[model samples]
Target: MSTEISIKDAAKQLNISEQRVRTLCRQGELESRKFGNSWIINAESIDKYGLRTAHMVAEDHPAYNVNEKCKKPIALSFFSGAMGLDLGIEKSGFDVRLACEVDKYCRQTIALNKPDTALLTDINKYSANEVRLAAGLGKDEEIDLIMGGPPCQAFSTAGKRKGLNDERGNVFLKYIDLALELRPKYFVIENVRGLLSCPMEHRPHEKRGDDYPELGLDELKGGALNFIINRLENSGYSYSFNLYNSANFGTPQIRERVIIICSRDGVKPPYLVPTHSEFGSDGLQKWNTVKKAISNLTSHDHLTFPEKRLKYYRMLSAGQNWKNLPIETQKEAMGKSFYSGGGKTGFLRRLGWDKPSPTLVTHPAMPATDLAHPVEDRPLSVQEYKRIQEFPDSWDLAGPIIQQYKQVGNAVPISMGNAVGKLIMNLLKGNEIPSFNNFKYSRYKNTSDKEWKEQFSKQVLKHKESTEQKELGFG
Candidate 1:
């Protein structure tokens, strides 16, 4: 005849330490009765105590809103890898109805943190109506926002740069198709900075002989982006896109990505407001540093450099890379890589505590993209990566160690996601954003939409001119 919860569940529901819960029970501050060594906390007592603890614990926990009514403007996330973007959007007060992801590891992570949210594994298998139903939406109901970053390897400069010709690139196109079908009021598509300059057709390295011919003059320099824009325009949506550095928005890393914001009613998309600046100019705070982000951590597991690389890391100081070593030592350490072109800054690099971390790579041990710790002899740990990406301490990321690294490395920094979410919320509410024309949004300033288009035109024209001459057999 008695309804009660075990002490553990009470602590969990109250968002407090179990010891604190037990102490309260012992003191009779909480309405509970002890059953031998175990405490039988009255269910009513938990409800009463939760109200008081909810306010105090809400700042650091997600369970505080258990009894609150659901907010409006629901979102459906596609390609929701580890839900970093979804987390940011949720923080902005939007309810995420469902998430679609395909990667097994990423799906596990999402399922672990977002147990209540419906998750679909293969997007290709579901129609928009099916997805809506899966999200617990009525067939006639409209989704307020759709957002995701499709797999970006096809457009990544670090990869083969296959653009739309690659199967993954085709999947990017499918996401756009799904967005059109869903008819969301607003949609955001994010991708790598390389997408800004990717050509429509894959251009093989010229040294591979004349097997691959030059592309025609009519080809756009950023073929994939232009195609996406054309498709959205034809579907009666207006959009604006810009390359953003995550550090500009308060994340502690210098990760850059392209975000395209589209509105169904053809309204011009507003730019993301900057919260930090590189040097504290324009009334903004200085960029958060890696030291501030992860320096307080006690010992945790991390990937270590092989002894061969550790030998070189030992000789470097904070902020120094392979280039900082004595010239003879650099040669001795780098061997063949010493003569390689490009900055090669990632080689034997030790991060500086005062500056934002260089963009995180999927694997930190690669010679070309090493992310060795500032004073430690190992790569940044999974915990450090989470902090750098601005993921909450309590957010669970489920996977093996390597998979965890990929999930964190590939995430859109939560701060950047929050900025995007805020812009969408403002648009939804018809709020006029204050202009800060003088503000710098990144270490490299954001390129205006017009400026980007003009630059693209010039690059395409330049390439066309060169290609035409080659067709005429005139150098």
Candidate 2:
């Protein structure tokens, strides 16, 4: 038997769309056979076609001009998982000189794609000068930008919400210190929407009730984000941040993240303009949907649902969840979680082909966050995850199957990254950015940069007032 790979993998390896691969098979440009509802592609045919892999640039390629783009701004990336953000920055014409990551697999993935680029293993171990040297930058060189999404689980609502108390959260502060040390002209920080609401101190689970007594003033209403803003302001940097839904920026997923852009010169950064709208309002294209993103995929390899859960999945249709099943069946499927307070939407959930996918979780088979395919009984395939995250088809994730899912799921959507890149480019070029009025930044509206700053100021003032009162023995 000849060596073979699934059509989805073949598409990824060949750096082409899955539909294009099928077209090649139909035109006898490649050899393939049907396996159930999927296609098995001949690995030998892929090699014979001389298709260039993703991230590999031949010196003779038309896109290759070593000296023409030498003036591109330089960037240093921290917590660069799979380089999704870096890729976006690079696409926007920034030269990513180095990336810092601690995960072995992520480091492998980065090294695989960016062999020449310096990969710093641990942020804590390296000094600012060391990072600069690793990136081949001299001490006198001006670092144009530093960007990354520090670990967000500490602030993620789904997690412990430890804020600055958690060691990972401390790393977030360290990231800020590093940026200050490097004194880059600009810096970018990205995190989950949960960061907006995460309190500086984690409230005890037993005391989480609405009727619980109000906390002291030091425990302000705004979360760690306020502290971050205060630090930046005091450090003489001006910043703007807003929550953004990736769908608004042409990604095929409804993932939301808080993007904070800062400038060392104390000038407020402009907002990122959305290129797509939910209903095609504002003269933008309607948000891309899951169907459009993966309809052409002829093969998939996904995590298997247990036979027990598979039965319920078989009964559900696209856009249907446990709620769509019969009352008796719903109870049977949900078990103890059925009586829980929340919507329990993820239980027995099937994606809607027309809708953008819900945020991709690290695991698709979790009880509370299942991401079952719309019609298929199984979870989304690894290839589908890559597509939804906007990672190039040929980008190789270095890990086991489960680890691959986690890497892709945790990535910032490539489209969102590209949008950030564009914003940075515009700022660098000193171009005036166009504005959108009445823009909905995330699922929640009114999260504009101005509104966020106003809210943050209020919380900071409250904290200061409380501190002064305590000093005067008025506590």
Candidate 3:
């Protein structure tokens, strides 16, 4: 029942000690049940259990419990959000001994799910030696990997794309330096797809046309990543990267992320091998769908939409958006955004049953990016978000429900994590796993390390030739 509460919460509501509440449960004055040792105060005992509890006790602390006696490969994680990527690596036979995160909610999540793993804050504040010590590695124990998806808002396409100029982007650069300093056998950097095209030094669009000199290398698109690659090359590391669709790796959501796998060893690892594909091409499985992900759910915890929005939702069918409504209704539903440019596909939209769900956003009910359920009159629930992200059904997220959604939404899909792990594992075992030829890694073009380098070279050459023409009166 929804009214079921936790004993800790019951103690607060009933104004009694948690011990007193436990005694009541023992004396049969209250009805309580257990899920992994945490108690759930039953709905039947409304006076004692009350409505504060949501019927689930989150004894999910040991979710990623590891055996200390067994020494798998060692890894250090930074900017670790919800440990989604770390879990994938852990499952791939790595002992993830340390995780560094700055978000308070994420720290709580890490403490809950990985009690034994060392937790740190602010990647910028810690030295490489401090990080190694925090991970509990003895002086001679070498690290196999260092991984992070640094705060990516600087390179997010939705933002102004400040790239390395932004403070957050500077921190990303710091993570890179740390990796090199620590000298892990391999290092992985996961980031938003926008990183592929972001310039190292952004120039305002208004400073363009004949008014500006030919854009320097730092100002050109893809310059930021080029700079990062150059930094690694100067340090003697080889890398391979690609923009990968999470759906291609068996995730139910169609989120695309850029994964850069680097090595202290000379040879670079291949692109992540796919476990699924669109249309099930190349003998891979078909893309997982949201309908397949949540069809059996009988109950869900969720945030609600306003009645005004619900009325329009009732008029629309699964897969329909504001465009599906009557012309007048569409205008009303979209308001001024109806007249805006680009197909506002997210406005007043309902998810399609057959298709992979859209990229999960931190907030599902934001006007321009609604993520309503296909049949229900609400946005995708936090539980649904976790399932789509491939977190286990019982993985207890920390923070309030809204914060919970943010944590899950921002997570790297676990399937993608597993693929990253598998690739690293193969490399460590001296297995060279080449990717399937001609496979589409993502919707974008020229994003692979090979393809992107060629493109960057061409862009640089074009700029060089143009500058020469201006100098020699060949223009």
Q: Please give the range of 10 consecutive residues that has the lowest summed lDDT in model 3.
A: 54-63
lDDT per residue as tens, model 2, 76-131: 89999988889888988888888888876676677566666777776788788888
Model 3: which residue pairs collide? 5-53
Considering lDDT, which of the candidate structures 1 and 3 is the better prediction for this target?
A: 3
Error of 3 at 166 (Å): 0.4
Model 1 residue 111 distance off true place after TM-score fit, in angstroms: 0.9
Global lDDT scores for all candidate models: 0.81, 0.82, 0.85
For 1-475, candidate 1 gives per-residue lDDT tens digits of 6588898988888778899999999998688987999899887666545533331121111121322255578898989998889988888878887888888777666655665677787777788878877777777877899999999899898888888888988889889999999999999999988887787776556733455566643235677777788898899999987788899889999998889999998887877888888998778889999999999978565788999999989998889998988999999989998887888888898889999999998888888899988998999898898989989877666556787889899999998999999999998999887666756554444365666778777877787787788789875
How does each model score on TM-score? 0.82, 0.82, 0.87
RMSD of each: 7.7, 8.7, 5.9
Q: Which ten residues in a row have the lowest lDDT in candidate 1?
A: 55-64
Best by lDDT: 3
In model 2, where do residues sit more than 4 Å from their true spots?
1-69, 203-214, 456-475
